[model samples]
Target: MRSYAGQPRPRPLPARYSRQELPKDHLVEAVLVTIFCCMLTGAMALIYSHETRAAIRRGDIDRAFSASRKAYFLILFSLLFGMFVSITWVICVLATLYAQRGP
Candidate 1:
């Protein structure tokens, strides 16, 4: 319909038109895995996770993906290294015990 001056009014916007969609940057997983496994690699993963979120906010999809991948790899590496250290420690302890057995 037209106004009193005979000018047609603009169409109304949809109720949900102003919503923004943000990316999920696996920050929690990074921190948790790092805290329980390897602090050094875990810190690296946390940094990358934060970078992923920032890249998403900046509308850089490629950068966000790269950062996410880095975080994932860091977490994986931390877990692997943690396992390696644990296994080595167990082996050393066993060897020490055997040596002390008077064999």
Candidate 2:
């Protein structure tokens, strides 16, 4: 349709940007790691993960980022601690077996 003289054309609306840089909520991973590793850390991680989603829903970008970082660190710490405990347990078992086999 042609605009008559003095009539202004309608401008197109700007595209809405998405929060693509936000971290993913790893609730399941946190729960699984907590079960296999340390329960407390895992629980904390799960909490943070849930908080991240909640913050996102609430449109609190800073809170979401903070929660996401907390969750990530908790998961990592839990995994590392779990691995350390397992290694120590294995070493103790090996030492016990060797001591028992003394000639």
Candidate 3:
């Protein structure tokens, strides 16, 4: 392509396979964040499971059922939180890439 001054200009790289790759550190950070969230969720589940079982063994059916319901809600919340973090991270990476290209 011709430049404004009549000189040949280099073509811009394609977005899908551009020379500018996402930084490795950013990818690692995202992965680490995801893993951390998962671990937290798992720990919470374990705690809830143990509490529910204990309540059940004590003949407190109401307490055990309540614990079970709480556990389900906690799991749902965890899933949503994790998804939000992951999507935000992806958006951040994409924004960084676009910014690097100078608008």
Candidate 4:
């Protein structure tokens, strides 16, 4: 365990990859998408979130960050698509109601 006099000093790692900090998993957003938005995308988001968590556990920050980004975009897309569908349904329903009222 003695250090050799001829060995070079090891450089420190960057702060971002430190064990104290981890990439975002967006698990909460994934769950919210599952509960309130499209099931398909929500399920996909959940998968990505799980992957992110697993990568972080395995000490693979790059994979974790990639999975986290995927999950985030999936949640965003699911929420937007859900809102569009809901708004379109509401508009159609109101149009039908107004037509039936004949004024």
Candidate 5:
């Protein structure tokens, strides 16, 4: 075994224990997925609000009521999507941090 200065040199990994590397596109994939989810949520909310307003203006009580329900549901879905994205981001950040620290 060779030594580096006063310390022993680090040993190379054995063939049987070689690590499996992730693809370079993994980060891009993660970011795109997050953005897509957010955009979908925003689109749903916007459509719901616009339709609800139109229904109200047209004096269609039944349509307005249904639109109101849809608006609330869209808002709820957006909130849930936001929470999911945040949680996923946090987990990814933590995983990266831990991975960088090595075993």
Candidate 6:
């Protein structure tokens, strides 16, 4: 066995779990969206991300996958909603300015 000078490698997961790729938890994205986007949807995404991490810890593959999917969708929805609102606000502001200019 070869040893590196850096931190030691983590112990291998059980054969059952290690055999296949794990789903993403999306915890970071959830947190970011919660901070910078729609709070309600972002909060929901954060919850789903927590659930995904928990299920992953328990080695419940199906549950983990489901929670990960939910988290991803929530994050996406929050980003889209935020973008929609931002664009709408900008358009309204520009329209107001144009109206005030009395062209």
Residue 84 C-alpha lDDT in model 5: 93
Report the C-alpha lDDT of model 6 over 1-103, residue by residue, as the tens digit: 9877994444445577754578898989999998888999999999999998777777677898899999999999999999999999999999999999995
Residue 49 lDDT (model 5): 59
Which candidate has the highest TM-score of all? 6
Q: CA shift at 73, candidate 3, in angstroms?
A: 1.1
Each model's TM-score? Answer: 0.71, 0.80, 0.57, 0.81, 0.57, 0.82
Number of the candidate with higher TM-score, 4 or 5: 4
Model 4 Cα lDDT, one tens digit per residue, 14-100: 566775666788999999988898999999999999999887766667888899999999999999999999999999999999999
Q: What is the C-alpha lDDT of each candidate?
A: 0.79, 0.85, 0.57, 0.87, 0.55, 0.87
Q: Cα lDDT of model 2 overall? A: 0.85
Ranking by TM-score: 6, 4, 2, 1, 5, 3
**Tens digits of lDDT, candidate 1, 1-103:** 8558773443333343332433457799888878888999999999999998777656566677789889989988988998999999999999999999985
Tens digits of per-residue lDDT for model 5, 1-103: 9766883443443344323421111223233433555667456555655665565445444564575566566556666777897899999999999999998
lDDT of 3 by residue, 1-103 (tens): 8557773444343455333331111223233433655657645655665666565455455565676666665566666788888899999999999999994
- How accurate locally is residue 49 in candidate 2, as Cα lDDT from 0 to 100? 99
Query: How far off is residue 33 in model 2, in Å?
Result: 1.1
Residue 60 in model 1: lDDT: 66
Q: Model 4 — TM-score against the truth?
A: 0.81
**Ranked by lDDT, top first:** 4, 6, 2, 1, 3, 5
Ranking 3 against 5 by lDDT, winner: 3
Task: Evaluate model 3: give its TM-score.
Answer: 0.57
By TM-score, the better pick of 2 and 4 is 4
Clash statistics: count for each candidate: 0, 0, 0, 0, 0, 0
Error of 2 at 1 (Å): 53
